[model samples]
Target: MHKTLSVATRLAAVAAVTLLGACAGMAPAPVFSQDSLPDTVKVPAGHRVVLETVGVGEITYECRAKAGDAMAFEWAFVGPRADLNGRDGKKLGTYFGPPATWASNDGSRITGTQVAVAPAKPGSIPLQLVRANPATGNGAMTGVSFVQRVATVGGVAPALPCDAAGAGRKEVVKYQADYIFWKPA
Candidate 1:
């Protein structure tokens, strides 16, 4: 009987420790630093990151004439369609549209105007900063003030020939980028 009680107490202590460890793991995740990014893509002073998401999907480009020169055909950006995911790889939202919208799974959404952009590495999309418009539906996006797109891997316009023969053609390019959301501190 004595041996049994001792073993039972040890098991109980082990269970308690396991529970405490799990609770500790639930603490708020540490925010990522933006210091390594270019000044043009950095969030403004007094803003804090509220979320970090990786956007994975495709950007569409359409073969069209250059804005100022009809004779100069190129791939014009159509828009983007992507899944926004948390660091843990869970789908948290989506990014899409001609108007450039980001929508959270909980129904919150926002559009933004481009603030600036800096070139990323070769063959990658540019790093970008955007000023968020007022959010709709009220959730994770409610107070978002800015978004920075970084760590780009692809999503450049297609390398295929864009000429009069291919006018109006559309192509999709895969891309992955880290999108950090921020709000006033």
Candidate 2:
């Protein structure tokens, strides 16, 4: 019975590893370029390419009072989560927060402002043009000047009816997008 239990445990571990490998293998390759960016994501005249990360995350929303008469669900701009990955399917870091931050594995971090937006589809979250904060870390994010989020998928919250009774109700919606960083040429 001891031997049989050990064999079953080994088999389960092997199956788990195989499943993880398959998921990694199925990650899509990065496929966008500077030329493919939409006009809304305007890179300044002197900025040059730095790096791009493609990954998936969530966009959170909460029910809040709109104007004076009604309650509506709107983006809370915080608490969304994403795993930023490299072309080889290795995780490099994470993207999160209301101001929208990309924190890299090398201890570098940066935040950006949404200067422009173009909706990905009818209901999906839009691709965005973001202006980066001055680089503060001495890692991959050093000297970063601008960032663009494009080729997004998912991340839209359901259109549930919200009223005064539902104020403060929160929901997390799933999403995906490519984040491209740039620096002055």
Q: Count the clashes in each prediction.
A: 0, 3
lDDT of each: 0.95, 0.79
lDDT of 2 by residue, 31-149 (tens): 44667667887687888777878768778787777665453444344467899988667899899886678899999999888899876876777788888897667898999988888
User: Which lDDT tens digits does candidate 1 get at residues 25-90?
Assistant: 896767889879888888879999899999999999999999889999999999999999999999
Model 1 CA lDDT for position 109: 99
Of the candidates shown, which would achieve the greatest lDDT relative to the real structure? 1
Q: What does candidate 2 score on TM?
A: 0.75
Clashing residue pairs in candidate 1 are none
Total colliding residue pairs, candidate 2: 3
Instruction: Show the lowest summed lDDT stretch of 10 residues, model 1.
Output: 1-10
